[model samples]
Every structure is written in C-alpha cells, then in structure tokens.
Target: MSRFIAFFALVGLIGFALPRSAASQDWQLTDANTFAPANYLILTIPQDEPQALAALADTLAADFGVSLAAEWSLNALEVHCFVFDARNVSDVDGLITAMETDARIRTVQRLRSFSLTEMFHSDPLLPLQWALQSMRVLPIHASSLGEGVRVGIVDSAIDNHHPDLADQMVDLFDFVAADPVPLAEAHGTAVAGIIGAAATNEGIVGVAPSADMVGLRACWQQDGAPGVCNSFSLARAINFAILNDIDVLNLSIGGPEDPLLTELINVALEAGIVVVAASGEGQELVYPASLDGVIAAGQVAGRSVPAPMVDVLTTAPGSAHRYVSGSSIATAHVSGVVALMLSQDPTLTSAAISERLNGSISDVETLPMLNACTAILGPSEACAL
Candidate 1:
C-alpha cells in the first residue's frame, strides 16, 4: 500500500508542465487556495491557431483587466480551457456578461463551490453506539469485514495519521492542494471514521471496520468553519475515482445542480461503481443525489441511517475522537454497509444491493433504517430479530 506522504513527495518531484497561454503566462496547474470564493472564471474557447488563441487571451486580459491563471487544451474535444483571475472580485458578473457576447468563446461561467453536510459536535465517549446495535453490524461482520472492498471518500481532507484511520486508508488524493496527504479536516475525518476506521481496541469500530479507504480531498476546511469544495476540484476527484476502479464512492456533501459533476457521477454509476451521497436538507434532494443511479441518504431518523448516534463515535482531526451529526454521517454509514455487501458478494449490482438494504429494514415505526446482517445473509439466515 502507498502512503500519502510518498505520493505527496512524488507529485512534487514529477510535476508535469502545462502549456503557456498565448498571453505569455505560465498556466497555474494547482490553485493555492481551494476553498476560496469564485474570484476565477472558467472559459472554454474553441481550439484554433496558437497565435489566434494568444491574441484572444491578450485581448481578454487587456479588455477585462483579468490575468490568466491557468490554460489547458483538450485536443480530443477541440477546445481550450482558460482560467482567469479577475482583479476586482465584484467585477465578476460584469466580466461574464461582457464575455458571453464574444463570438469566439464557447462557454464561460464563474467557478462554483460545494460544501460538506455534517455538523460538528464534541463530547465525552459513550461505550456503545445505538446505530451499531440497530443495524446488527456485528452479526454481518461475522461473515465479512469488508475485505477487498475499496470505499472512496470524496469530501474534505482526512486525518491520515489518526489512530482509527491510519491503517484502513488504502490511498489518498488531494485535489484541494494536490498534497499526497491532504490537510485533515473535521468533516472528512469524521465521515471516514463512520465508514472505515480500524477496529482497534482503543477506538470506536467503524461500520465496515476492515474495508479499504481512498481519501480523495476535493474540499478544504478552516477552523470552526464548514468544509468547502469547488466544481473543478470535485470533477477531477470523481474522474480519478472512475479511472481507478473504486468499488464504492461516498459523497458526504451536497450542492446545487451541476452539469459537469452530474455526468462524471453518471459515468461512475454506469461503470458499476456504487455512488452514495447525502440528500440535501428539506424535501428536495441536491445535485448528484437528485441525479439518477445515486443512493440519496437522508437524516430523517432513517434510505438513511440513524442520525445523532449520540454514542456513534467518529474520529476528528489531531487524533481526537468525538461524536458527529448529520446527513453526511448517515451517508457514510450507508457506504460502509455497501462495502460489507460488496465484500461478501462482489457480483451484486447497485440495484440489487439497494433492494437488499431497503428490504432488510427491521420494523421500527415508519422510520426505515438499514439491517446489515439481513441485507447480507437472507432474513432466514440472519441473526434472530
């Protein structure tokens, strides 16, 4: 298994060079601040003569008073993407309005960012989690500890060295800063703890304790603030997950409708990778979750698991353990259960898995929650209710 530190060093040493734009500016391959607001715009220009493209960049820079931050060509798509940073943040709308009229530009829009769905909470540990018992996790684990299953966490940076997560992590990719071991944050670390934390005697056991985890950091977090992720970083991470053949992808975040991200997730689903996401707060579902083929998890005391598992322990940054709440954590629990199902029967399709999970819910009022043991073994073979 490759550690995040090794990947970070390798990224630094073997950095790939980007083509300079016609404006005579070197392309900015990675953003210095991933979570910052939309001071930048993504412009799609038709592929043309190098001089023509350069002249266009120069003209745009001069007219709009913007600077080219990054530029890349998609030869197959016959287009070039140019990222420009506006000198005046407030001028973004004006610039977009003016650029939309230019005949040469294919598409232009201000970059959009997404966010984690979890709410942070810290408290003293309670020995047993109600969720674990409710789901009959132990009985399912008797057959499979999610061995050989890979769960991709597409969220904020995770604590790579946390005692509960250190050994469960199989890989790490930081689209946020491109660091090998992305900066750890509260949300991702907690979500990861819910899904794949190690079953060490000292800490809380995770839903799929032995499953493999790949922390793809598309989001960043600041102290005492919610984690944030933009479309470009998230698209890159999801593309990576698809290319790498991840078994199950957990998206413990929510955002508005986005065409680019929707398509990437669609491709992943079509490729037979199970994609799970938090259903946004309220009655309506968010993008990706609202899109077809995704298991939308909600926190209604329920396609979801129990919320406020007061005893549901999760890992936090700085190697600390704490309790967390929200639809994001519920999504993680579902992802973990999926991992367990996949481990036992790698051939199960996403639909079949969903049916088994929903069908196995033990009657607990109108609120439906997962029953892992019954989902894995037939209800007849499952542990007695």
Candidate 2:
C-alpha cells in the first residue's frame, strides 16, 4: 500500500486536494423558508420553464385563500410546486381529493417524514477505523484530501464549532424547520468527521478533511436522540443539491419507499451528481439505498468477528469523539473516497465511478468492500477483481 502511495506521489502525491465550498452557499432559514410548516401539503403544477411563476403563485394563493409560503421546481419534469398549509387533517385529505380531480394540477400529496440513519454513541476510546485503512485511503489521501469536491450531508446540523471540523464547513442549512432543534450533535458531527474533518492533529482526522462540507440539515429530533425528517424535508435538501450543482450528495438516512423522494433522487442523478446511500443491517435493503443506480454501502463481514458486532470508530459531536457503528458509518467511508476520486477528475461520471467500484473488488460476502486506490488506478493493475 505504501508503494501505491509512492506511485500516487510521483504522479502528484496522494494528498487529497478538495476544499470546502464558498460561504455563498451558507444560508439560514428565513420567514420565507417554506418547509416544516404545520398542516400542509405540497402542490405541483406543470409549467415548462414557468414563464409566469408568480402568476401561478397568485392563482393558488387567491383561489385557495392560503399563503404561498414556499415553492420548488422539478427541472427534470419541467414543473414547479407550491407548499400550502391546510387547517386540519380532514382539510388536507379533502384538498388532496379535490386537487386530484383538477385537470391543471400535476401532483399533490401530504408531507412525509424520515429518520436519521440510526447511530449509537459509544465510549471515546476505541480501535482505529479499519474501514478507511482497508480502502487504501492513505494512498488516496496522500494524493488528494478530496479537495475541490462539494459534499452535501443531509442530516442534523453538524457541530459548526469543532476545532477539527469548523473550517471544512463551507455551508449549512436547516431543511426541516427554520432551525433544527439539535437533539444529539454526535451523529451528524460524527458523519461530517468521517467525511471531511480537517487534519489538524486533533482528536481524530476525517476521511476527506479538506473536502468542502455543506450541512444540509433535513432531520430534527422528534422523540429520540436520532434526528428524523419526512419526504418534504428530504426533497428540500435534494433540490438544494441539484440547484447548486453539488458534486456528491450523501443520504445517510433511510425510510419507506417514498415517491417524491425517489423522484428527487432521480433528478439529482440526472444532473450529474453522485449519490451515496446507506443500507440497513441484514440482507434486507432500505429505501433510497434500494433505489437502483445508487452506490449502496454497508459494512464488510469480517472473517475474525461475528457479523452482528459493529466496531467502527469515527467523529462525534462536541469536543470529544466517540465510536459509532452502522451502515451509516460505512457509507461515510465510501463517500470520502468518492470525494478523493472527484477531486482528481471532476468530469468522471457517476456511472463510470460505480462501474470501477462494483467491478474491481473481489466478492466479500457477495458484497465487495471498495478499495479506493484500486478505483483510481484501475482494478486490473492495482486491485483484485
């Protein structure tokens, strides 16, 4: 592996080159922020390049006697939408029924919710994360630290003040509400640390420490420590990625099969963004991850340990770090590696990257663990296929 480092070094050193995006992406919720409103449904209308979006907004606002609190556009489908707040659940259902019969309307549905990729808070003292080492991340990092790549983490807000992670946060937003009521910062903080905690010789280094970090907070604490979000919130974050031309979008959260969320992911993929998702434990896959054309990630079933035990160590919230385990953690590993690859070649399409990853690694429990070095050098020369 060190030889691989020498090879990458001669070719420009394996120190990843990604850096956080500009502050222009940094935005907080304002009164105009349309998501997270109560007793509301999203209404869609077909308009190819909506020449008169305000006119349509006025029509909906005037006819329904409601405010046009927020709006979004599905460029892939050539339609725009408005979020409308109804008085009660009955009114929401009745409005949906009435809208379904309207010839001018395209799509309408009640808002949905999604939960954080469940993670556990463990003791600070833990083993080194082998997931990164196993992927030959050192060689890749020596060549690039995922510089110039923009990764949108759609979870709870990250620790904006962590010494190791503060500089990497180029932008942040709360999609669920004006501001997410942080329940446990460790989960999102840990994920951000895994993806790109700055290499400041601090508690722990991140996978792509220099890569640009964009906190797209779509989940908020509802009843437990883990954050939860619905379809509407998820859609808001995905649309942000598409509109802003984000390089990679990380969906560490999962829930049931949602049509709106599915369509939004499709839009992101079509716009040349690489989406990495986490699969739930066990053979059964979860939504978003189960969606085809996505790079689904999970832990490798190690030969020395029982498959039931998860022992991955990564970044946590606050000043102290912790050990957390789940497919969510594993997905972060892949995401970090993707950033490195993108840093080297921004034009590399998602399909080509997926082909190299899926085709290069030899089968390990029918789901091969990725090797970052091999992905860049081509499996035929650097890895076992």
Candidate 3:
C-alpha cells in the first residue's frame, strides 16, 4: 500500500486540491482550449519505475513527437498511466499501434470524450414537477431521507451556495481546474439538486434531501455549452471516489467504452461502492453504465430521440431551477433512490438495488415509472395506491 500512499501524495491533499505538475498544466490548457475530444492519447507503463517511466516518455518523444501531458499511478491496477499530447492528430492512431508492440508498455488507448445526459427546457408549469408524482417521492421520503449517506456527484461543478444545495454539499473538488473552489455549472448543480438538495419551502426539493453530496467537477462547461469530459479527467475523478470511501457514485455522463475508465469503475464496484450511470441514447448501454455491476437508468418517460419530452425540475446555478430531460437526469433520480435505500440498510449492493427497483416498477404509467415507495419500503407500500 506504500505505492497507494505515494499515489495520494502525488495527487496532493485529500479534497483533490492537486498541485499540478508541469506536465499536468500543459494538458489542462490543452483541454481548456476546446471541449472537443482532447488531442491526447492514454497509455500505461509498469509501476514503481520512475526512471524507466521517464526514459520511456523520452523515448516516445524522440521516436514519435508525442510528449507526456500528465501521469497518474493506478495502484489498484498495478500500472502507472500516462496521457500524451500528440502534436498531430495523424500521430494518434500510429502512436497507439506503435506503442502496442513495445515491451515497456502494458496498454494503450485513444482518449474518448463524454457528455452529460441532460437537455434544458423552459416551461412555466415545470414547478408542478409531474415526475415526482410519477415516482411517488413524497411517500418514499417518509421512510428515508438518505441520512448520512455520502454520494459523489461526478459531473460538472455544483453550485454549493445554491439555496437547495447550500446545506447539503459535504465537499467539492474540481479535477478540471485542480482547485477546491470550482465554479458552479448548470449540469452538476442540476444533478445535485435532484439527488440531495435541501428541502425548503421556497425552492424545489430533492429526492434524498438529507444525503451528503460531494461535488466532483470532472466535466467542464464552457460559455454555456454542454458539459463535456474526456478519459483522463474521468479516470482521475473515479479513482478519487474509489480511494476516498465514497458510498455511492452518481455518473450522469456517457461515452464510448474505455479500458482505463472501466478498470477504475470495476475497482469501485469491487470495493462495495454503488455506481449509478445514465443509460445510452440508442438500444445499447454506454460505457461505465454498460459495465457489469453498474446500475443503468433511463428516463421513466423514455428517451428523447423521436419526441421532445419534459423530465424533472431541479436546481440550477445562482438560486434558480430548470426542467431537464434525458437519461442523464433519469440517472440522478435513480441515484437518489439508491441513497434512500442505502440510508436505511447501508448494505445493499448494486445488484440488490437494481433488483428492488426493477421489481417495484409501476405498470400504471404509459411508460414504466419507478415505484419509489415500494422500492424503499417494500411491495406493501406500492405506489399504485
């Protein structure tokens, strides 16, 4: 575990107040340049060989024109992963192929980008929140407030000062900026509001108002554009969640399948952390959600491919709220339900929670609705009543 200690030391303080190494600052600026998939490639080398790793990085720089942008030691996977900023887009495919044949390299992958599963809509009647009625959230709240459960909201920066989330946020970390005081963004604030915003008379209430929420800003939003994240940033946040003893992780983002991200997610699952993610837009489930031992959730009203749909009303940045719809928003509600169950029992596995939710789905709604009351308090408390 000494290597794990070294890993954390390299990551800086506990709340991910990372002191960026020279290499890290380079990619931060590169990723900052545009939200489009970063021109970076991910590869891994053996652990405990700093000299060998540096030499390999130099060899790649000399042999292929790519330079190390950032590196993190994945203790659980027993490999040190590196993200290289390719000078040319053409160099990426060739570099990955060339690296695969090297004895020093354990694995190599092209970086994949991901985005939040939410779309914002303006509707005056959204304050009524029909989705709450569909889920029977009020009755479900009678049995559980998700008291004391720690849920990691792995998305954009949440507005910690938003009235709904002010008292609920336990911690905040910005992997995008490597700063503790991350700027509030719409997507993350909305997800936090849905999962565990403080219940108040003035604003909309969350599904599990009493759960402890940790705002982890892995995805970044620029100029009101949708929030986006790449494999390097996602892996860091997931690894932080796994090592920090976070009880539940809410990932409302999706992308193509990634090996490094998958390894980190599997580690979290094996450690008894329940991971909930948004289901895919098409017929298949996306990465992270697509992985085994993860709970895949989609909108109760169905996805928004062929039709424009209204989803849930939740918190937004700066003392506001909005109606957001998508498998992304749906994942938040499901995560809140999991918090409710965990708050009561504290031992439910992802599989058990999934089974409970599936068994309790209501047939009354044209589209299947999660019977939150029955899911939390058992079949006798079915929402059909």
Candidate 4:
C-alpha cells in the first residue's frame, strides 16, 4: 500500500554511490557531443590500484564538467559517464586520447541506446501455422480459443481506440493519472496485443484470441513519453487486479525486488489467480518473475532456437510484425497459454495449473529451452519421466 511518489523519492535520495568494488577505475569524459541526446560512455581502465582509480575519477570529474554515473569491475575496468551537454563531445575525444596516451585506458566504447522497436523488428516469429505444424504443438485455431477467461494486463494504458483491439477491450483503470488513460510508452498496447488481440487479418493474432482483457494503467507517465509505466504505479495495479478478481495477470514490467509487491503477489496467488511475469533481458532475473507463485517466462527467438533465456516474438501495433522479445512478451505467452488451460477447466486452482504446466513441459530436461506447449500437453509415454 506504499504510494508511488514516496517510493521514487526514496530511491532518488540514495544518490549515485557506486559499490566499493566498482570504485577502482577513474573514468574521464573525453567528448560529450559524440553521443546525441546524451548517452553513456563506457571506459575500461586498468585495475591495478583501487585508490588511484577513485582519486582519478574525482580529479577527472572536476577537470571535465561530467559526472560519474556508475562503475563495474569485470574483466578489466568499467565506468559510465553521464554527459549533460552536447558541447562536451569534443572534450570526451580529447580525454580519451589523453587516457590512451597515458597507457591506463585500455578501451572506450559508446554504449548504444537501443529502442524496443529495433530489438523486436530485427527478428520476427515464424508464421504461427509453421510454428504449430513444425513444433507439433497444439494449434491455436479458433477451436482452442480462450472463451471465458479474463486477463489483466498491467502496463501502459491501451489505445482501446486502435482498430484491432477497439472492440475487445473490456475495462480500463489508470493508476498513473488523475484520469484513466496512460501517456507513458505504448507498452501496454503492445503487451495486450500479445496476450489477447482479436484475430483480425490486418495484423498477427494473439495467443488467446477469445479471452477478455482488463487494461490497468499502473505506470506513471514520464515527461514526453507516450506509453510507459513505472514500478510504484505497477504495484498499485497488481492490488487492483486482485481486488477485482481477474483470472490471470500479465505483468511485463519488473525491477529490483520490492517487499511490498512481493506480499501483494502472494496474496493474489492465495486467492487462486495465476500471475505471469517476465524474467528480463539480461542474465539477471527481475522481480515478480523471480518470486514464488509467479510463472517466470523467458523469450525465445523462433521455433528453431531454444527458448531464448532472453527474447520472445509477438504482435506490435500497425501492420508490423516484430520479435518483441523480453520477459514481458514471454510472460504474455504464458498468460495466453494459462488462459487456454483455464478454458479447458475454469475450476483449476493456481497451484494445480502451475503443477500441470511444470509437470507437462516437453523440454524441461533441457535446462532453458523448455517450451510451454510441451510442458502443458505432456510428451508421449516413452518420453515420460
């Protein structure tokens, strides 16, 4: 029940204090304008002396008008500098040259800022028909549709006005605004489409075509961002879903573990609702997905590769088809599959549903490439454990 503003304020107050191990390297800003709109510059410095690195960082920060954002100790040395102005780009180059000349700096690279769109469009899903036929998975034909289940989509608010989803949207709740629409990132719309978009020929079909949708805008809008949600608002949205008795909850956003959110998820599970969460893109597992009782889904590229420990493919708005991979998209697929299972039997408890899912997996033997359909449909008796 903690409020959003208070939580964010608390995180802000912590300021930028790099962990002890990361404080070893001195990262100097060379040129700021090299990156437009300000991007992170990564520097790898020698790690022979820790105190020297910290002192160097302090001196560089004073010499150049840049701030030390973060640092990590890895194979060599890692430092991130936040550039405030474009004019510093030239300064950054000069700084790099000076460091390289001094023999301390090993390498410097600009951290590329990637868009969700670029990530998704780079790889697309195999045609649904091909996936079903080749994988020998259950066909998501009109016959296996999720007719009576309700899925609560917690993310940016949906357009509801979009042509494909306009009529399928059932209810709306905006946890971010004084009103019911979200203005952050179109994240909700994209997630919602992945879960239950109607079967319109203009775009790709959702995993659960017949399921009803409940759009909850729990993320606060960032300035100038059109469709993104924040963590605090997300916690509120989860509570709202439980109170409203949503059958399935699809959470695509995650962050560090929040004790408050964890408690809420336990309560919802006890109430018999199935929660599906994304495991995040990197090696680290994000919360809600990592928590007990939540199905942590990882992304897969196509039918060919093993389920990606980090990516998934689904529908995006317009006529575009993108890989849309993330723990978020993977969570939606799990939610859709859960809806399909629920449609098979509405009375199944959350625990029972989870058991069936874990017990029936086809690729559980393979560590990470486990497919859900194989999990739910169970392999032949010869493959049974």
**What overall lDDT goes with each candidate model?**
0.75, 0.67, 0.73, 0.59
RMSD (CA, Å), candidate 1 to true, equals: 23.7
**Positional deviation of residue 61's Cα in model 2 after best superposition, in angstroms:** 87
The total of clashing pairs for model 4 equals 28
Q: For residues 1-385, what per-residue lDDT tens digits would candidate 4 score against the true structure? A: 2111111112121134343555544433344224542244555655535666667666655655555655544432234323223244556566655545655456755544322111111112334423222222333332456789989988876767664566667888888777543332456777777677666444555667778899888764355364455567877898999999799998877777888888988998998899888777766567767787777766422211123323344444443444545566566667877887788678988778777655544444454343444445455421233
Q: Write the per-residue lDDT of candidate 2 for residues 230-251, one digit (tens) a residue.
A: 8888899999999996998988
For model 3, residues 1-385, the per-residue Cα lDDT tens digits are 1111111112211122112222232122233223223477778777644556677778876776777776666555676667777856575677778889988789987665432211121223324766666676766665678897999999998999887789999888878874465478999998998898776445776778899998878998889998899988888899999989799999989888899998899999999999988885667777777787888887423321111124578888888888888778888888888899899988788778878877777654466677787887775523553
Best-to-worst lDDT order = 1, 3, 2, 4
Model 4 ranges off by over 4 Å: 1-143, 181-184, 220-231, 299-313, 317-321, 363-376, 380-385
Local error of candidate 4 at residue 220 (angstroms):
4.8
Write one digit per residue (lDDT tens) for candidate 1, span 296-326: 7765433343323334678898889877777
Q: After superposition, how far is residue 121 of candidate 3 from its true place, in Å?
A: 25
Model 4: worst 10 consecutive residues (lDDT sum): 115-124
**Evaluated with lDDT, which candidate comes out highest?**
1
Compared with the true structure, model 3 gives a TM-score of 0.64
